[model samples]
Target: MSENRKSKVGSSAAVGNVGKKARNFKPTMKKLISYLSDYKLSLVIVLIFAVVSTIFSIVGPKILGHATTKLFKGVMAKISGTGNIDFNYIGKIILLLVVLYVISALFGYIQGWIMSGISMKVTYKFRKDISEKINRMPLGYFDRTNHGEVLSRVTNDVDTLSQTLNQSLGQIITSVTMVIGVLIMMISISWQMTLVALCVIPVSMGLITVIVKYSQKYFKQQQDYLGHLNGHVEEMYGGHIVMKAFNGEEKSVHKFNKMNGQLFGSAWKSQFLSGIMMPMINFVGNLGYVGICILGGWLAVKRTIEVGDIQAFIQYVRSFTQPISQIANISNILQQTAASAERIFEFLEEEEEIPEVSNPVKLQNVNGSVEFKNVHFGYNTDKIIINDFSASIKPGQRIAIVGPTGAGKTTIIKLLMRFYDINDGSILIDGHDIRDFTRGDLRSIFGMVLQDTWLYNGSIKENIRYGRLDATDEEVVQAAKAAHVDGFVRTLPAGYNMILNEEASNVSQGQKQLLTIARAILANPKILILDEATSSVDTRTELKIQKAMDNLMKDRTSFIIAHRLSTIRDADLILVMDHGDIVEQGNHEELLKKNGIYANLYNSQFEVA
Candidate 1:
């Protein structure tokens, strides 16, 4: 038990040490306010309701004080034998107080109803905007960012913003109004006592400000650790099977526990510091309450203040501290909201893909011809990958690209598909620059089967139909039969309707590859890109898939990237790539006689087997 306690204490200190001074937040806040500008009218209505409700509520204590004065005077008069009790006046005052309280509650409810809708609508629109922004972002952006970080921004940060708006937006306005109103009422009763009560404001604010100064860093650290923890967990879960197979469970868990501990420490400190605000504010309030009551009693005894006035003054003193405390709490919440808002804005402001042609040209009766004219390109211009690379292919050509790892094998396909634009030079399809076509139109002409198989949680048939949404059942089955996906799919418990599960773990990797092939075959694109498409399957399954691919490649431009030389032996033209440059280009028979890099690569593969 002692060790556990010590560990927790140490964990908190380590996490708390991540504190760094925050930079200027004015620009981020100004931009976020700009997003809220569209809801100006709705906010105006909310403001009106909040002000009216607060005004009505704040006026209540003063009117109730009138009833207290009336009751006190009546009792005193009866005891002094000066006059009779005026119960009628006292009853009227109490009735009006009840009516005022009810109206205040009604308006408060209406304000909350309207504000809830506005807050939710704003968050919904922000979420929608982020979703569209994600699509507009280049693939390179995703490559550089973690999937969980992006997801957390969408779910976590957006939720934090929404929650802050809902809980604190109205509190800020109402608390300010109540504080000003209470001060006025207190002065009207007894300015001397009001002066004493006013002392709580500065004391509470000072104490809270000092605590907040230290707490803000922890809050920011909490958010960062939360994001990192989420990303790490997502990665570990994604590769859980591989981790366990290699006996990496202990390492993964240790890393997770470390991150989780940091998150816990920061989260607790932020909460603990913020939580102290209420109790401390309440303590100072009680001190003021005691001081004011003592001063009011002496003033009443000296006949400088009436019994009713003293009662109203005491009520005013209590009400004053409540709003001050609420405002302090709201200030802390604003800091956290600002942190979440900054993260969200950063994602929304990321650079988008380059604009497409204003007046794009259409490919009419495309002959599947492609050409790379002195294309100079790189993921980053400082480090050029494909330099002065040039290639030309006729329609219906079976071109295989062979290269060692990191030789820009996949970069070539990405460029042709326009997933990433070339930095310099040009790529033309049928003599027309590829840039002259919309990305949607350019990508529409090609079918890609990558090494990774992506199947969402759905029925087997639904996954295939994703290729061509409008494809008929007959067409889906035909494509499946052609790719041999129907063979194993039919053996499942529910056959074509079998659920693939979320990770698509219900089927083997080889089967997943076959399903993707079926999807591509169903789409029947004008060009085909097979990137190690048969790497996951067995020799027998590879033969079946290869036969299907051969039939599908007829009369279509096909680019194959493979390390298996046997698979590409029949390729009409083989381009041997090393360090992003093609060193040799010829058919199997011709390259063999040359005994160049292509021959060496082919021989190495056979030797490995």
Candidate 2:
């Protein structure tokens, strides 16, 4: 028992081992820097400006030292009657410093413009690539992932990395240049003072290394918790009606509070450490400055160095410390930016489910005969949903599939649409395997109406036109009339142009279903699949919908799936499925005569209704 407890504890540590993961995780800085390859000219300009800016900045302090030293010498010369004091050098040095300041400011503006453009361009590229990849992905990929996670990756994560790349990169470059330039200038003035300044580096480095390591872990956790919170909020809001109907608000709030509390703690820790960076580095910088001032003052009093040189060294110490503090402060932003980059790259690294064929087959003008030959499939490998399933339908045959829920009813339609490929066997269209046809050519032949319809935020006309992008207004009207939706649509103030937001939420469920029927009809597909299309509507509406379905299904190969068995009485073939196998199949009267599974389901629904 003791050994088992120790093993369990060890397992727990492995599961929660964030520190080990972080240590092993490598940031994609090299890949990120490759984005700058296209911006070589801009980068060159930035580099030039940074160098000029640092040079000018370094000169300003040295000029002040020279001027102060000259002024003191002039006073001494006058008191001692040393004949003359030269103000010419002082005047030239003052002018040079002023000119340098002007050039530095100009370069600063140029650098800002170029880096901002580069960052925005990189962000645009990242977003565009993600969008394109999403378009090419299989539908099942989205079914398993949260919508909010995708949104956060594109918006929040990309935005965070963009700011870091643009602003932080520039600051790091400028700080390093300024620090180098100041130290070089300091050594030229007096190596003794340069040595004193260098002494602070060890202490500053030790403190920063420790703080950064701790802050990095917290920052990454902060991002992860925030992602969880976003996912929770999106899920809760998306299912609000169901939650409220079941009075699950308290439970939802408790879940949200738990996620929110974790986010709050991680965020506080990350930000608190980042916030302390400037002040802590500033204190260290001040200590170094005091040392420089004290040591330089002593050297000057002993006449080992000119008073002017001491003054210049003091200014150099100030300049050096300022950039060091900035570098230390910017380290936090760098870490955060690196964390965001890792996330964005991670998303980009996900392998797309549907890869384009090296030599794709483009099929044209398909005839509607479909065959499923011993198909086996599953969303995952462990549990096969459709096993050794075989079905064949002739052109324009209307088949109705009635099954218990989770008996691979909807899975059939999904597989037919290539939303997923069969694990074994082949689905054939026009006697040709579906995998032999290009995805576009294969999907173009079928139109599907689902149980839960989706309408985009657009005018009514636009939603119908989505079925056929180039469909005419007259064509749309004809389809709408056939679906029996034209009557309600014409009554709206805007007629066909009436705007619908939140997917026609203001309309009744039956009307929404009708609109979807109109869309499917507009497509004029050779094959149709209705997955419980009329199940949500009232009896009267269902009858009306049945008439529309009759019109739509005419002379087309139609696959209808529904648990409401009464609606499928006129189907050419009725397949009653149980536990992923067809238990009975025949015409409606034949199935009724058989007194089998279909008859039992029919009687059960009739009793319930």
Candidate 3:
């Protein structure tokens, strides 16, 4: 039991450290406010109405207290002097209360409408900015980050901020103003009783401070757990097929349960602490109220204070305590909003890839003569995947690159496309360095089909049209036939209009690869790249795909990366690669005679097949 207690204490200390760091870790209020810049008018309107509404709230309670005092005095005088109630005085008090109620309600509506508009405008801009930023980010950024983490930043964090703005801001403002107005009223009624009421202020604040410290830590943990939950679920769902095939269901479930249990505990702790806040404040408030009541009654009965003054003092005490309690509640929300704002701002501040040159040269109708001069490249600064590599291809030549896995075969194509700039060399397209051309110009010159073909959820016609947005229906059909995918499309219920399911899961792997080839064909690029394109298909499908590829390669520069040697047997040039260097180069017969790495690979998989 002692050890358990000590462990709990240590865990609490760690949580305390985290919370303190989060609270003091620079609020992004200024950065978050920038999103509201576009809606300056609405924000100003909200502030104006909130101030007016708060003033009305303070005035209404004072007017009620004043009317109650007047009624009591009038009743006492009438009963003693005339033995009848003063109807005129009664009517006046009723009229005053009604007037105060109407004014308060009117300002309340104005405040609500204005704040609602501000919240909506801010949310809209927040979503739009994040979306645009995601689009502008380099492709490699997404490769390194999880999908669900990014989603949590946009969807969950922004959603939390939206609620804080809509529901909490106006109440906080009004509550604060009411507290100030009530304090002044209390002093006017009876300074002694007012001081008594003030005694609880510091004590209540101290208690609230302790609770807030506890809650802040749990809230931050809660947000992180939610993000983890999102990421875990995404991973489990995306790889369900692999998991089932490996018989890893139990393992996956155990992992999920552990994460889910943490999420549950964190959520409960956060909410439970927040829920206790209101009641705790109320309890302290009741204690202060009782103290004030006893003291004020003693002074009133002794005639040191008026009966009316005691009544007003009690009213003021209630007003002060209520707003302080409300402020405590708002403080909790602000902590959460601050936590979410940190995440959203971090995303906004992420480094984007360098922007395109102001005036880029556009390559028109590229002839597809490619040259790599002493190219050295790496995805990261410290690691070089391709070192001092060089290659040249004349227009319309079919060059095949064969290598063991991780020999930088795919890196060649990436460099040509400028996905990551070369670390130590340059690439030229038709005598102009590729960097001189705009991204669109460089990409428009080549069409690609990878081993894992991905199709969007859309009709076959639409997917093909994505390759060349301006293509006519006839052009799409021609390209499909050229790629030998038209026959399969015609067999579907909707032909070209048939909708592909998610990631083209509804189609066979071979058919999906062919459709992707059709997409590449529709673009009519000057150069073509086939990166293990036929490896995932059946023998018959490979034959048909090879026939289509041969037709597609005609009069175009083609660079083929293949593991199977038979696919590249007839190439004009075959380069055997090892450790990012070209060790040998020749046609199939020549490489076979040399009997190098290429010959061995060919003998193992391709020549024998």
Candidate 4:
């Protein structure tokens, strides 16, 4: 497999390695907060409302306890027949309790609305920044990285950040507020009871710490194996045809079963461990409750505290424990958020393409003359591929580059397009360094058609018009006819209007090549490049394309990278390359007469045929 494909497979297997802990939690969170700085005012409002809402909720049970005490006293008085029960006083307490809860609900709803908007706005900004960053990133980065890895940052990581912001942010504020407020209420009622409730926390926390520590590794394993399983399945499905041809179904199934069994084992263990936490903590809390109730009854018998105080303390105890659990859960969620935020920040901070010159030269008319003067380059600086290469082509000349595989043929094209910058020397066009002109202007002078044809999901006419967006329907058809695509397109239903599927698999490979050729023809560029462009089509169709290309090459500088020597026999100049240097250069017949590398390469093709 190619290095790029290997990187993709490795990336897929490691994708689920996320959702664990962040390497730099504090720094990641600090940077994430900087993004929210833009919405400081809104966040403040949310904070204030959240605190207010939680306070109201915290006070509700205490107020209701007063009503409970009033009712109890009235029953005692009526049974003793002492002065008649005060029904009106008890009714007033109940009414006050109802109003407090209703207002609490209203504030909670308003805060939730504002929090949701803030999270969505932050999500939009994250996506927009990532989108723009992708454009500015150097092509070298993509050459070494997996496309799926980049996509995961754009989709999965951003989504994780968004959900945490929308849901967990508010929960964090409320949970903390509840814990503090309920603790105060419990203390105010009875310090003794508050102390009893506080005892449950240490035990609960100890068990929780142990559970999380053990289950964390299982959770990570589950996610890791889940990624592996998904990657294996996707690879198998994508290459099912190749697998069947090789009759490797048994191997594929066995691999899948192995991964599936591992995923099941880890998933079950993680879930079971996580599932036991709540009941375990609740059992600990129940023991604390038992002690508090016994102490409360003794205190009431001695008349040291009101019945209402005991009831309110119990409510505060329940409220306190719940938020502690919520806070613990939110802590885990925050860790995941930090991990996601770190990935996004790392992408945004990556080295961008070399900055464009402030005053780049603009060419009004390109003459198509090009020269490579001692150009030195390497995908890696340590490993020079194209070393001190030099070549010159005049205006309107047909130049053919022929070499064995891995002879730096495609690297030459990539250098010309400025997809990568050369480490040494310079490439000149029209007597000016190519870098003097803006990359956009430099690339605009040339039209390229490569072996791997690219077509989007669009009607055939639209695909052709992509070469020249301003071209009218008549121009599109003329270009299509020139490339011999109009005939086959007309035979299909809907003709040029037919919508291509996402993969553009609806058309044959040769037809796809023809459409791309039609696109390049419509560009009407001053310089043209064809890299094994006719390899997909049969000889009969190739002849027609060659004729059309010949007409299009008139008065235009063209470069052809071909393996088949017979195809470029009529070139104005043929350059034979090997190991990143030109071994020979001349017309086809002149190179053949030399009986050197070019002659040997030409003879071998015919021998293979």
Q: Give lDDT: candidate 2, residue 245.
A: 98
Give the distance in Å from residue 303's predicted Cα in candidate 4 to where it truly belongs.
1.1
Candidate 3 ranges beyond 4 A from true positions:
1-20, 81-83, 302-309, 606-609
TM-score of each: 0.95, 0.93, 0.92, 0.92
Estimate the Cα RMSD of every predicted model relative to the unseen true structure: 5.6, 5.3, 6.2, 2.9
lDDT of 2 by residue, 293-346 (tens): 888888888888878888788778878878887788788777766666777777
lDDT of 3 by residue, 1-609 (tens): 110011112111222323232443355767666666877777677667766766766665566665666777778888789555556776786787777677878877887887887887788888898999997786567665666667788888899999988898888877878888788878777788888888888888998899888888778877766766676677768678889999999988887787678778877888898899888888888888898999988887888876767776776787789889989988888878878888788778888866777778776567889999999876667877788898888999999998888788887887788876788888998988888877877888889998768789999999988889999999999989987889989999999999998768888888888888899999988999988888778888788889989988999999999887888999989988887788899888999999888878988873444
For model 1, the superposed segments whose C-alpha errors exceed 4 Å read 1-18
- lDDT (Cα, tens digit) per residue for candidate 1, span 280-371: 99999999989988998999899998888877777777778888888888877877777778888888989999988999979778789999
RMSD of 1: 5.6
In order, the Cα lDDT scores of the candidates are 0.85, 0.80, 0.80, 0.85
Give every collision pair in model 4. none
Query: Over 4 Å off in model 2, which ranges?
Result: 1-27, 78-91
> lDDT: which is higher, 1 or 2?
1
Which structure is stronger by TM-score: 2 or 3? 2
* Predicted candidate 4 versus true structure: per-residue lDDT over 226-344, tens digit per residue: 55666676567656768999999998998878878887887787677777777887888889889999999999999998898888888888899888877767665665577568778
Give candidate 2's TM-score: 0.93
Question: Which scores better on TM-score, 1 or 4?
Answer: 1
Question: Model 2, residue 587: what's the lDDT?
Answer: 90
Clashes of each: 0, 0, 0, 0
| Ten-residue region with minimum lDDT total, candidate 1 | 1-10
For candidate 2, the per-residue lDDT at 168 reads 79
